[model samples]
Target chain A: MTSRVIFPHKVLPYLLLVPQIAITLVFFYWPASQALRQSTLREDPFGLVTTFVGLGNFRQVLSDPDYIGSVQTTIIFSAATALIPMAIALVLAVMADKVIKGRGFYRTLMIWPYAVAPAIAGMLWLFLFNPTIGTFAYMLRRAGYDWDPLLNGNQAMLMIIMAAAWKQISYNFLFFVAGLQAIPKSLLEAAAVDGAREVKRFWTIVFPLLAPTSFFLLVVNTVYAFFDTFGIIHAVTSGGPGKATETLVYKVYNDGFVNLMLGSSAAQSVILMGIVIALTAIQFRYVERKVHYA
Target chain B: MPERTEAGTTSRSRRSPWVSHAVLIAGILIVVFPIYYTFVASTLSLQQILRPPLQLLPGSHFLDNYYEALFGGLGRVGGINVWTLLLNTSIVALSVAVGKIVISILSAYAIVFFRFPFRMTFFWVIFITLMLPVEVRILPTYKVMVDLGLIDTYTGLTLPLMASATATLLFRQFFMTIPGELLEAARVDGAGPWRFFFDFVLPLSKTNIAALFVILFIYGWTQYLWPLLVTNSNDMNTIIIALRKMISYADADTQWHLVMVTTIFAILPPVAVVVLMQRWFVKGLVETEK
Candidate 1:
């Protein structure tokens, strides 16, 4: 929607737009277009020759067992990373909402973790759960639990997931708190007047009304798990225990930067680009319909 | 009594207030325990931490460990001290936050306040960038950095990161909410684009700018992967990347004491920012994401 009243300046607007446009073109568009182009081309190991191979990199990347395993890992990682924190946050938000006194105090304490860097969060958890030197790991072994995340793939995945989820809980908690606050009090009061029990009142009134916020957080937490948790994985597990925690983003970095498999990495990057586009589309669609809830 | 019961059920009485506080206190403990343990670990000696099930209480070596961490250079990271890493991180975070605000506000002003050809085209261009995070286009972006000779440079670390859509979109959304009459009144008084921007737009967006600053500074400070790839030298390392360097996955190679110390240092500024600017931080977060 254009503003009805606007300056009729010709060159000034273009001048004003230069810095953002220039940066976007150089850093964002150029690299993205290059990824597309590089995905179709292969460079020889000797760095002496280049050949155009149409769709071959995509074919190889898609067919590779390691790549397939990484995709499976990403799905599991993203789902758990998205859900665990969301569930924890929802419970905390509900509790905070119910408490009449010290609501702000509890919120302040809880939200501080939102500021902790994911890598730092991962490190804290890593130190606490490190099989040999970790405090909790010591407790676990004493209890007869086999707690070596470094040696077991599933255990390693769980560790990173917890670290990732721990960092995200504050974010989801804040959103859920905001969501809970937005529900009309009259609706709940009416349910209570009808002799609906507290749990029944919440299920019949609050949960249904909170669908929009829940849906929005779902999309956001999915995006966070997909892209932003790279730091936690890198710091905590480094996608270890036989690539068990190797997410799509981590694999892209590993293949391109570490292994120098540019063609395959670029193909994987293009596929990631498609995934992001799909997610962004869903988000924008939500934005269009968001006004109804408001 | 019945009236009080009804009133309580409406807002605050789904359960006893004690139950809510109890659950919330437990939640807070779970959230804070890792950091608390890290803090406890930071103050202890290496031998203390190396031994499993370290004491939960504070240690006697707090001053000594902190002194070493603040002044002592990590041997693995080329002896660059924590202070320099903190300074580097501050520069990156401040520059990214300020630079993004400047560029985005200007663009949003142009798009919202002026009638220009291809304006929607430019908006779409910036909007599409939301989908292309550094994770997806890692290699090509790094290539651009190398080709531009920006590797290990401060500009390299912060500039590529500033190329995002969130701030511009946020500014655009805020600008749209501004009353049209304000611009009309300025125009009638013969205020040009530059004058309107400085006098009306800038002043109007003061709170928004502050809010965005809090959020963006944290975003800049917490960056891990991009800085990891761009800066190879210890001298160029931000605090987050430096923390990663100081850590060794192998048990024996790592100094748990110093690592804990650096972890606290790494998190302090951003956490302080969030706590100090809690109101604006929350506002900026909800606004930008939604």
Candidate 2:
């Protein structure tokens, strides 16, 4: 991992590393350790007292109906967030790949959404879905649907999903386009010689070739729905119409910052950290395997 | 990977161009429509926005709406000027981007150039942090910020976020590609590590640094949950958080016109960066993730 002509100086290297290490120790490791330690201890409502609860916090969080519901909500949220964006992105990317006209123009126009803040994405969609002033809400009501995200849990969940998915589409579209472009033109032509139509060619050849990228995107998208969509939920639904849209990350924020449940939130954070570590491990593993092939 | 495929090319040319263009145009419309509506809304009067059958075209109130949003008078948004929020956001974004690049490149240099005890240890410590996003550890991190009295400060907003592994990893990967012969030659010429780094390494790193700056600046700009937790005062709010405040949804009188104006202002800088620096943006994102 090091150069052959390495610096023999000990203190200089350590000094070079000190700033990053110091920041990591203080901000990352310290808080992480605090979360681990605090997960075993319960604190009273006032800033005064604490009691050792051992694994009680974990038990409480794991067994809570609300927390269980959040896990399910996160799964659904992540799945929809992953699937919808990837599907739409794949469709768009394939279509863009087929035609040569205005190729760069289409790409530049489509990816602007990637630059919009997730919170602002929520705001944009929220404006469109607001019952009173929302254009879509007006259309929905005109179509005789009882459409109010404010009062409807399902509608709130859908709103956040749409907003989150919208933000992610450009990112997925870029990757999918990249992945699609990497497939050798010969393969598609080879399939064409065998009488495979575009649909058959895509299913038998292109789809199989995109497996690695699709898998990588799946994990990344899951982690995103778990974490990055915090803005979308916060700005759009705030985890409500009665906790219906509270993903695991939002629950950590709500329980810790809003409700002042330290031990519980810490336990939840510990769990979330574990989940992320696992996800990152999977991503890196795929990356390494791809590197080996390359 | 280009092929002649004369027959294939002819057949593909005969394939329906209308269908692909139609689907692509539809996709573009979905992606661009929200942003277009935001622009359209920002140009309209509040009465026009709330009134039924809102005009799809840009209205005559564009200057007045933007002027009000930039100055003040966003009702229920706590008297914070858009200028103050923009300043806070730019400061935090710049600091995070610059801070991350500086510290990461140095540590990467240390790891790559020197052999020391616990060198692997330090590498793992930094590398492991790639997984721990701020959202995963907000509470304890917030408590630490509170204890250190960093809460509600620019330092709090930027510093904690700067302990990033992605930049360090990116720099490490870039550093590995620097031919060892350059360093050997520098040493034979009696150049010290600092001199060699400044003269040779830093110049080589310029493109990488610029690309990374484009990505990290956007990362810093788009942060929401961290700023939402850390900055309690209106004065400390970033434009994103301020927009959230302005459009709290619970508030009935959320001057939609003004909020739309602020939304446009909030996203324009980063979107401009991404569009203008498309090459660097793509390179930074793709390579860093890998």
Q: After superposition, how far is residue B140 of candidate 1 from its true place, in Å?
A: 1.1
TM-score of 2: 0.96
A67-91: candidate 2 lDDT, tens digit per residue: 9999999999999999899999999
| Per-residue C-alpha lDDT of model 2 across residues B164-278, encoded as one tens digit per residue | 7989988988888898888889999988879988998899999899889988888899999899888888888999998887777545576888888888989898898889988
Error of 1 at B225 (Å): 1.1
Give lDDT tens digits, candidate 1, residues B65-131. Answer: 8998887777667899888899999999999999999989989888888887899999999999998
For every prediction, compared with the true complex, DockQ reads 0.69, 0.70
For each candidate, report what fraction of the true interface contacts it reproduces. 0.82, 0.74
Candidate 1 chain B superposition, TM-score: 0.94
Return the TM-scores of chain A for each candidate in numbered order.
0.98, 0.97
Segments of candidate 1 deviating more than 4 angstroms: A1-3, B1-11, B249-253
Q: Over the stretch A1-294, how does candidate 1's per-residue lDDT look in tens digits?
A: 543788887999999899999999999999999999999999999767989999999999999999999999999999998899889999999888787678778888888778888888888898999987899999999999999998999989988888889988989998888888778776777777788988887788888887887888888889989999999888878889889999999999999999998999999999999999999999889977988778
